[model samples]
Target: MGNQTEVTEFIILGLSNDPQLQIFLFLVFLLVYLITLLSNLVIMVVIRADPHLHTPMYFFLSHLSFVDICYASTVEPKMLVHFLAEHKTISVNSCIAQMFFILQLATTEIFILSAMAYDRYTAICDPLRYMERMSKEICVQLVSGAWAIGFFHALLNTVFALKLHFCGPSQINHFSCELPPLLQLSCTESLTNQVVLLTSAVIFASSSFLLTLISYIHIISTVLRIHSAEGRRKVFSTCSSHLIVVGLFYLTGFLQYTKPSSVSSVVLDEMFSIQYSILTPMLNPIIYSLKNKEVKTAVGKMFQKFKFLK
Candidate 1:
């Protein structure tokens, strides 16, 4: 304790240090952030406005859009600011809060995706009992459970992080204050923190991923059993958007976190992070709109309403 020096703030070494690049990156990320917010907000609004879309599938999707908005909002706003700021420093407390929210929202989103997979599974595998199996009460419980688990998972990580002492270098080599980069800065032995992070991440991520995988396996089996090609295509289309989303989220995230340290580099880290964290949110609404006939119809009707008012 006597030799420990207090670190009140951390200097964030953003993606680039070049003046010209900073300005360019600022504009690029700002545009991406705005698109993320707008697209997600549109998805939520469209889902809410259409009563026909109030099924279990769209209910999960509306929540997913809301989570995407929140997940991007957690990191992009600060990152955009950092792109223009010369110092690009964040207080210790702010960094912790940012990490907490990022973890919570991200965890919640994967579970929500898992829930969607289950919804699709029920709809396709047992159409007659779909309404009974996935009632409004059950859907609400699934969403609420996701949120509750995410909150507690983040809280546990944050509590452990608070115990770590950062007496050494305060420079974070990534765009945002992620747990991995932050853990590297602690002067104290971080073995326990590392263990907890790895253990919990594996437990939470694997369980949700397994559930999604099982749901899809059952779905594919059922789809294959259908005799008509048109029938198979119609069934696949209903959940294809969600399948793409899950692949994007899990694959990028898995690569980012599970890559060998020997192959890790700052550029690779930033690229993977951007893929899952920034670009995915912007792409989600586009995927759903393109793949989903119902969403497209709703958006078309919405545009017609606006034109009529004008």
Candidate 2:
């Protein structure tokens, strides 16, 4: 293929066209973005302040919250701007950067969730050795490893994406800069890019998902061995939030990215991406806070402290 480089920027045809709907979506997403930031910040602050939450589980949860905040920040702010901006255009470099960060943070989140599942498994299945197993040092390494892996994974994808040459029809039919939408705008042959995307998605997503699934299998097996219903309930409560989060994250991600490229619909891809990237971050902190008693107590204590300070 000969060089056909011409387009320098992309026009993002965002979620809606009507003025009323644009304003409405802008407000709705603005509110959601703020709440996501506040909730995740609260989770992190409360976890750090409360001594009782200094365990490996809360440590992982705090990191998870941080990742959620980053994930939402990467996509939502740009989307909000697009909702109102007349140009709705982003430079190629800027678009690639957005996609890179989104992929990095999202990949980190999945790895972190897998770590959280392991933590739960250690807590419930081998309570006596939980501390011995998941020490502070180990927790730091795990979280760091997740971030590092995500970084490199994203780097690989971004490197491949960089090879794609965008020449014309630079209008992306999506709210944010994502791989699928961006690829559609590329004039260059995207065989290598698509192969890399599919390969990395399978490796990263499948491995983390399998780890989480295996951990949950052991967790369920351990929970069943307990004779008392209360004991089972307690154990289940500890993991139910994580399970729900995992399910939502994986389901939407799989539906969005794992489809055959020939059959992908831009509209459907955008909607599914919204579920995982936009809604999942907001839902995670709420789910954990609601389902976990310790988190609720920590939140209550933090609120009381704020009131006293006021």
Candidate 3:
């Protein structure tokens, strides 16, 4: 902490400057926020209520949905307010707090995804050990480790980001208080900031991506070697949706910040951020519930119970 200046607030450049577009954007985001909350709530409820869903996968699924809800809630409501009002300003403290939660939840999400992949790998590759290995204690340990890692990673990132000197204009180019957008406002020589940001990013983001990749590689190889086409098809469907989600998220995220920030286009930058922040949250629930027969069956059973109670 060199010279802690009195930078009190920052203005967020949300989705649009156009007045007409602002209202429209607000409505869309509001709808998205509501749906995200409801869907995640439903997921958590169903997982908690249903005995058939008391598996490690659904346990992780419930947590994953909860994390996405947390993730979207951290960023989207602020953006929605910016669209609704004139003041898009965030206090320095508010910005720092937002970044901390964002980092914690986002990193937690990565680990959860990787854990799910590992779950899939074991269920497929070592079916017999799936029950033995992913026991209640092991599940608790894995989830605990994910939360601990997220907390520490976010702690380091927030600490490092707080040290940066924001001598330039306090207007962040993006909606949220993310590291990339916040770094754009710093006036000092930001070499160390950049390095630290990149390293933290790789630690949380890349590690999960690499694990997903390796798990999928083994999955595909084993699937291909199966003698029956029906066997291959059946296994493929079980993992395909997750594969799609992991691929889309990691690719967009990697392209967005992994390269030189100076070289990336503002339009592309905004697009990638929006895609990752808004769209991906919506997609997570859909990807799991839509094509998954087990989820669909569970949903139907839930509906039937409600109707009978009425």
Candidate 4:
């Protein structure tokens, strides 16, 4: 990959072909994006205004909302625009930048999920010591660790992308600069890139998934040990949202990346990617917050306060 081979820009063949479908998809995705933004923003505002929501659980919840805001924002807006556009193409640098941010937030979401799991772990497995254990200092550390993990994932992935020499067909048959789509457009041999990326993804994904799984297992076990059905329900209620979220995130993501790179159906790939990326992120703030009585109560209180101030 010399200067001559270095790609200055990339072309993105966005979502679909039919103009009618483009308008329809655009409206649908636009609605999804706005709701995602609004929902996440409401979560943040509610969390900040309510002193009771300033605890460890709400602390993690707030961050999860923030992450979902960013995670969904990164792709959906562009995707909406791409739907209605004729020449659905993105510059090479822009594509790379998009890829970087998407991967970063995605990786961050993984670790953040792990941190949330740990919070549940402490809340259930070590109830008496929960507050003392998951203090402010620990919260900061967990958030920091999440960012660090995401950065490294993005950094390595970017390096691999940079190493890839794009010498031929410049059109990316997807809406954004996703890993598989980007790799497909590269002219040079990408054996090394594939190997490195696959290994990294497996290790990171496996470790994070296992950690979350173990945390859930411990939480469920503790719930079972509690004699009262209501006691078990109380504990389960706190963690059930997180379990649903993590399951959706990991499973859809795994479906996108774990497949052999040689599989080249752009439509199928883009469809799966959209599910994991846009739909999943948008779902988090809505699903996680709506399903929980605590968050609903917090939001209701915050809304009442807002009305009083008005």
lDDT (0 to 1) per candidate: 0.91, 0.91, 0.83, 0.82
Tens-digit per-residue lDDT, 210-243, candidate 2: 9999999999998889999999998898889999
TM-score of 3: 0.95
Write the residue-wise lDDT of candidate 4 on 1-310 in tens digits. 4545655666666777788988998888888888888988988888888787788877877887888888887788777777866656677777888888888888888888998999889988998999899999999899889889988988898898987777667877887778878877787887777777788788888899999989988888888899999888887877788888898889878767767866748778887888878888778888877788777998888778889999
Return the TM-score for each candidate structure: 0.98, 0.97, 0.95, 0.94
Clashing pairs in 2: none
Residue-level error in angstroms, candidate 3, position 263: 1.8
Superior by TM-score: candidate 1 or candidate 3: 1
Model 2 stretches astray by more than 4 angstroms: 1-5
Compute the lDDT of residue 71 as modeled in candidate 1: 89
Kindly give the stretch of ten consecutive residues in candidate 1 with the minimal lDDT sum: 253-262
Residue-wise lDDT of candidate 3 within 166-239, one digit each (tens)?
Answer: 75588888888877788777777667877877888887788888888899888988898899999999998999
Candidate 4 ranges beyond 4 A from true positions: 1-7, 262-264
Full-model lDDT, candidate 3:
0.83
Candidate 3 vs candidate 4: the lDDT winner is: 3
lDDT of 3 at 54: 95
List where candidate 3 sits over 4 angstroms from the true fold. 1-5
What's model 1's lDDT at 92?
A: 95
